[model samples]
Target: MNGIPKGRHSGASKAECRPFLSSTERDVIRLVHEPGFDRWLDQIKATGGCENPVYLAGYTTVQRAETGEILRHYSTENEPGGRMPVRCRNRRERRCAPCSYLHAGDTYQIVRAGLSGGKGVHDSVQHHPRVLVTLTAPGFGPVHRATDSAEVCRPRRNGGLCPHGLPVGCPHRHPADSSAPGRPLCPACYDYVGHVLWHALAGRLWARFCDGLKRCLASMAGIPRSRLGEQLRLSFAKVAEYQKRGAVHFHAVIRADGPDGPNAAPPPWIDTDFLENAVHSSAATGYVQAPFSSATGERKIVWGEQIDVHPIRGEHFTGEIVTPDAVAAYISKYITKSVSDAGGLDQRVHTYEEIAYAPVNPHIRALMATCWRLGALPEFESLRLRPWAHTLGYRGHALTKSRRYSTTYGELRDVRARYASESIGASDTLTDAAWRYVGSGHTPGEEEIARAVSHELRVARESYRERVTDE
Candidate 1:
C-alpha cells in the first residue's frame, strides 16, 4: 500500500494479516498475496466447483452494445498458475463424480418435467396418453442362472454331464450375488455370436418395434397405415440397462401425441389401454434379421417374451396408480451408467490385444472375442462390431428421447447458464474471447477442498428436496 492512502489492500499486506484467518481457509490465505489467486478462485467458482478443471490461457473482452466501449475485460496472464481452469463437464461418474452428480440431477429434473408437465411442456399433457414399457432381449443361451431363490439352477437327473464335459445342470441354489447368471452353462453350447449381434442391433429392434406399434395403433383405429403419420405421432424416452446375466434390457416411457407435439393431444380414440396392447403385440411379433452367418446361422432377433407395461399416470390421475415418479427416477438414474456388467471397456478398444487384456470377467472376454471374430467377416463389416467390442457389441445412445418427448439437455444447460449469469447481473453487447489449452487438475490441497464442496452440494440438494417433499 502507498503511505499516502491505503488502497484496496490492507495497510499491512495480507501476509501480515494471514495469522487471523481460520484453519480451513489457511490454504486459501496462503494465496492472498498472489495477485491472480482471487481471479482463479472466481473462475473455479464459476464452474460450480468442478473437481477436475480444465486449464486455459485466455483473455476476453465484453463491450457495450450502444457504444463501442469496453464493458469488461479479463485475462489469465497474471494468474499464479499462469493459466485459467474450467470445469471438465464430464457426465461419467468414473471420470468426474461431481460433474456426473450434477448431470444426474439435471436428468431427474428433465424426466420429471416431462412426466408431470413443466419446462415449456403443456400442463394438459398430464391428460395425454403415456405408458412405461420394459423390453428385454431374447435369451441367447440357457446360461446357468438362479432365476429365483426357490428354483435350483438347471436341476439335473442324477447329475448328468453334457457333451462338452461340463455338468448339464447346476444343483446349487445360487444366491443373488452368485456370478452364475452371466456365465454359459456350457461354453460350447453358448451362442456368443448371437449375443454380440443382438447387442449391436438392439437399437434397431426398438426402432422397428416403434414402427410396429404405430401401425398396430392405426389398425385398431381403422385408419390407413399411411395416414397414421398425419393423425397421430409417437414420442418416447428410453434407457438401456444391463442385466446381471450380461444382456441389455430397455425401459421406455412412451407418450402419444398429435403431429404438432405435446401441446396437441392424441386422437381421443387412442388411450393408454390401446397403447399397452399395441406394445405387447408389437414386442411379440417385431423382429430384426441379422446378416446371415454360417457359424451362428441367420438370426431373427425379437423382444423376449417377458414384457412389462405400466400406465404412466399424471399428477391428477386417480383411476390407476402409475409410478411415473419412480419410472422417471429409474430412467434418469441410468443415464450416467455404462455397460460395466458386460465386462466391456468403458472406452473403445484400439487393438485385439487390448480386448484380450481388458479387466472384464471371463464371460465378457468370450463375448468380446466373438465381437472381434464376427467383425472380421466381410458380411458383418456393416455392423461395426470390431470397434465396439468393448461394449460387447451394443451401439446406441445411453439415453434417447423423441424430439417432442421433452426438453433437450442443451436447453437445460443454457437455462442454467442464463440463471447463473443473471444471479451475477452479467450483461454484454459484444464479447470477444481468446483462449489456449494449458493444463488441468489440481494440487493435493485444492483437491481436498473441491471434494468437500462437492459433498456439501450433494447434501444441500438432498436436504432441499426432502424439505419440499415434506411441504
Candidate 2:
C-alpha cells in the first residue's frame, strides 16, 4: 500500500512514495520488509554504527555451474541503499567503541593463546618456566611521582633548590595522573641526549640483552657456546610503554622453550632460577653504544641502573604467581596505547609552528626540539627526526616478541576468519571480489539509533556473562 497525500501525488507508485517519508521511517520499513534484514540490522547494532559509516560497493553470489542453478544471490549494487551493508570501522576508543571493544577482545584472545597455548601451541607449555617482567627507565632527572607515603613533598636538605629556583625535591603525595608528575626536578641536569639516545637504541639493547641471556645460559649449562642453540632456546614477547616522563619502559612475557619452539621442552638443567639470573645479568650488563657525533666528536650511551625481573610462576610455583590471563591482558592493553597516552605527541612534527603547539611535557618538548635541531644538520640527516617526532625521535617497534614466544597475530586472524566462514557454512573455494570506499560513517539519526542499540546490547551481554559466571 502506498501512503501519500492525494493532492501531493495524484498517482504516486510505491517507489515514488518512499521519498516523502522521513529517512528513518524509510529505513525502518526497508528493514522490516527485507528477509534476513533483522540479522543484518543486529550486526549493524553490534558494530555500533556511528556518524560517518563506511559504505561498501560490492557483489556476491553462489551458483552450481554444472546445472546452472542459482543457489544463492547477493549484490550490493542492487540493494535498497545501492551498496553493500556498512560495518563499523571498529577502531579503539577514540574511533569506534563497538569496533574497539571487538579489537580488544581479539587482542586479549591472541595474547592468551600465546601464553597458555590453544590456537596451535602445545598445551604442555603451561608447565614451562615463564616470567612477566617490567623494565623501567633510569632517572634522567627528578620528576613528579605518585605516592601514598606521608613523607612525599618534604623539603630537601638545606632547603636546596635547583638552578631554575624551583624546589630541589617535592615531598607531596602526588596522584598518578597529577599534572606535576613527570616534570623534571632540575631541567638543566636532566640528560636530554641520554633520554633520546636510550629510546633510539632500545631495540638494539633488547637484542644485546637476548644475546647475553643466551651466553649466560650456555655458560651455566656447561655447554659450548656453539652448541647453545642446539641445547636450549629462550623466547619472549615484550611491549614498550611510554611513561609519564616520556621515557619508555618494557613489559615482557619471557618463556624458555626448546630450540624448535612450543612443541619441544627445555633441557632439565634449565630452571626458573637459572633463567632469572640470566635475565638479571643481561639487564645489568647489556648496553648499545650510540653513534659518534661528528660535530661534538664524542660518543656516549648508557643503560638504566634499574631493572625488574619477575618469575612467571603458575600454580606449581611456591610463591605468589603471575597468571597467564593477567599477563595477556596487561600486554594487550598496552599494545593499543600510544605515546600520546603518556603526555607525548601523537603526530610527527611538520613545521616549526607545529612544534610550538605540540602538547607534550616540557622535557619531551626539549627533546623534540633537540632532535629537530639535530635533524637539520647534514651530519645527522639519517636520523629522520621530524617523521619520528611523535615517537620522540625513537622509531623502534612498540611491541616485539621472540620468534618462538607464542602464536602469531597472523595465525590468530586466520583462525578467526576460518571460524567465521565455517559458522556460515561458506565454501572453501576462493572468490575474487572488488570493494572501494564510497563513503564512511552513518547519518546523525542512524548514529543515534545505533548508539542506543549498542549500549543496550553491551549491557545485556555483560549481564548475561555475569549470570553465567555466577552460576
Model 2: lDDT of residue 454:
64
- Model 1 misplaced regions, further than 4 Å: 1-49, 78-80, 144-154, 173-178, 314-321, 423-428, 443-445
Q: Give the C-alpha miss distance for residue 142 in model 1, angstroms.
A: 2.6
Compared with the true structure, all predictions reach lDDT values of: 0.78, 0.69
The local distance difference test score of model 2 is 0.69
In every candidate, how many clashes are there? 0, 16
**C-alpha TM-scores of all predictions:** 0.86, 0.82
lDDT of 1 by residue, 192-270 (tens): 8878889988989999999999889989999999999787888888888877667889989898888788888788799
Model 2 agreement with the true structure over 1-471: per-residue lDDT tens digits: 122112233355548777686665555544446675556455565355443457777765655555556555556665446654454544335556665565566667666766788877888887777777777767677777766656574446667777778877675777776777777777887877667767766777788888988888888888887898886777888888888888888888888887788778888888778888888887887777766776535534445677777776555455655678877877778766777777777667787777777876677788787777666766556667667766877787656777776676577667766675434334533334567767766554456456656676678779998999899
Highest lDDT against the true fold, candidate: 1
* Candidate 2 regions with alpha-carbon error over 4 angstroms: 1-43, 46-53, 61-73, 78-80, 84-92, 294-300, 316-320, 422-430, 442-450
lDDT score, candidate 1, position 105: 75
